[model samples]
Target: MNAPAYAHPQATHTVPLGGARVAYLLVRSRRRSIGLEVGASGLTIRAPLRVSVAQIESALQEKAQWVLDKLAASALRVQQTPQVDWGQGAQLPYLGGLLTLQLHPAAPRGCELLAVGEGRWVLHVPLPVDALPASVRGQVHAWWLRHARLLLTQRLQRFAPDLGVQWRSLRLTNARTRWGSAKHDGGIMLNWRLLHFRLPVLDYVVVHELSHLRVMDHSPRFWAVVASVCPDYTRLRAELRQQPIPEWDL
Candidate 1:
């Protein structure tokens, strides 16, 4: 189950795992087992309220290798992911390419959506040349979110019919741990950050979610459904996993 947005870690602990020392936030909940999650925010541990600290550390030791490897990978991803510059000539990712930002403070009062050429998209922001980066980032982010809805919806429509499924709705998500998810009722939630990748990668995610509508689980049958529409799903999936998305501080 998803935790409440206001929930916070109860405590923090440092433990020796594998050959490294790791620090993790501990959240005591009513759950039956201890759960360890590593994401953009580092490591978090969720354990039952009745569990002892020793038991929790023991579990951490049992998964020492896995935890260490994931933490190291997360660090590497952080180092490789570029932070958006949010400047007049800053470049942004779009459709597997980059879009150069052009600030036009005196030109107009809002953003101008322009498509010049292939991989030559330009976002004209109506902000001063010396405007704060937060302001610039907000405008650009708003534009990307709006554009992602249209693009993702179109892609979903393009592949859903071919896959013999009709998505009830398309919901853009900002989830950190998943690219997309499909509900039994055909509601599709796709991460808007996927706009950073190429068209094929976005299409693969769309197809993957649609396939889940036909087969709820990732069994062989579900993979077959995905392969039907995306014969190169394996490669595209890998590309999506291996590629690093730009980190937006906004």
Candidate 2:
């Protein structure tokens, strides 16, 4: 069942949490109780249509400490994550290593990767020094997308057979929160941003989704399937969560 448009109303309000004032979006619907969610953008409160604003504020007051702690943590994460610099000498992650960007307007009109020496790699772009940052970012993004599709397709084919499952399709996703998703029809959706991590970490996400084809839920058996292929899946999973992604959006 779904709530009608009139049954759910949304508004923003500021409430006193502890001694500090914090703002949150309030969404009222025909739900059973009030729900509080703290995310990157901040707090959001979902309350039943029958709940009054005063009551909602009172509930928020009860969880003031929790809200403040989450906000502080979110702020810290934002502060620690570095934004990507789109220019010469900037580096991007590639197969667990850093690939430095080098602009050479006279070299060529496309992007090329050259191994310098001693495990050093450079991505050569044919763009002028005065080129806009957005232009550089756009070209790099376009190259990455094309590379991601081809590389990911090969990886899926390699892993599916070993895992005794036949994947029908592979779709690269730009999802914000999830790394991958599996459908009962053998369709797998993997975030293209996984290219930023090491090969082992990316393999963990691939194996995790393929395991879901055999077992739909996260049961003990499902975990066993994942562990059989990746004995260090727990560590790889942590790396995926802790690794800071370069600011992809220009």
Candidate 3:
């Protein structure tokens, strides 16, 4: 049976799947989901403690299609960018360019963020470890996403003139299922991580959502509209198919 939605997380547990240990992670959220999450090393699953191993396995098998799709997407994303260490002075892709981190010395009081020059962004810190790992990473990610949204907005603004479409608003989120979405009121939502991809990939996603303003579904006509805007949509789609959704957690 499906677990209760919005319930408190139960304790973590594990089960055997073909002799490999499959972790059953309990996640408390709007809905309970029992699925396999692929990571750099391998897979970690989330399921209610009461769910039997048999049921978990069945669910995992049923979700194979979804797992495969996300896995492919994640792989492509990782391959597109070179390997990076998750620490200080790490280089990350931002808006079609590489940004290197610089840990500064003492500041006035706390850390202040600013784009110092063409490639450098200074984090004015009182101490090296003041904004350790997560804090530092979070701030940088926020900057990247903010810059990405601005760039996307500029690009989408150009499309409105051609198609007579008005984009009401835009939001960035870590959505797993789709790259972008269009709302009835002409609003759009995109995965902020798209900033990590190449410009062509981002353009494809932007065009895909803009096309939705004219035709809301993936019918033949809607695809034609998308094709008109992104002639190489097929190649981009294939590249997208190759990557998996990198699961930060189960």
Candidate 4:
């Protein structure tokens, strides 16, 4: 269940985001909230353990104007993202590379990369022109994620055995704020959109999460571990922060 939200126990802090007076509806729980995060996508009202719904809404109302404005801005950004046809000649970003669509009426209603160009790749799909964008995007995202995951696995497998660490499973994540995370049981969560970044950025993220196997927090020791494994990680680390994921409909 989504945890009930309440007034942040201590006090409320306010900040301005995008010329709007953004406020925090701090809802405290035994589990530190995922936290109030406003981004270009929208708002994610994270629920904390043992919080009250009334409090969350109360806070929501208190900042309704800010919420609406930010959400509207998010909507505009999404609107501004031009859409493409499901047919041939669609342009999409893939792993810091460009993918052009080449719709060929073949296969049992699935998709695949038809071929590669000198600096671009082609995604082939046999879907109707009016096909649902959500379904089309989901398929493309899944295909690329599978490919990226395979490559990521290949890279990490070489490093993991040396550290006596192994990942239980690998899956695509759609989280807005986090690029990757590691579980105590050796599970790893990675944003599928990481495929949009350059190789160094992707490597840094993979190493960052893998380093969590030894240390869980963003402490000095964790950085040391990350650096020890992936030297020149500092530059890539900064790059990941500055590089924004390209948003696609889904």
TM-scores for candidates 1 onward, in order: 0.78, 0.73, 0.59, 0.67
Candidate achieving higher lDDT, 1 or 3: 1
Better of 2 and 4 by TM-score: 2
RMSD of each: 6.3, 7.6, 8.8, 7.6
Q: Enumerate residue pairs that collide in model 2.
A: none
lDDT tens readout by residue for model 4, 104-213: 46733556775476557887766665566765676666677778778778767767765567788776788765688898889988877777777777878888888889
Model 3 local distance difference test score = 0.62
Arrange candidates, best lDDT first: 1, 2, 4, 3
Candidate lDDT values, in order: 0.83, 0.80, 0.62, 0.66
Give the range where candidate 2 is weakest over 10 consecutive residues by summed lDDT: 2-11
* lDDT digits (tens) for residues 192-236 of candidate 2: 988889989999999999999998767789999999888899999
Per candidate, the number of residue pairs that clash is: 0, 0, 13, 4
Best by lDDT: 1
Model 2 spans with C-alpha error above 4 angstroms: 1-74
- Clash list (residue pairs), candidate 1: none
Task: Give the Cα error of residue 127 in candidate 3, in Å.
Answer: 6.7
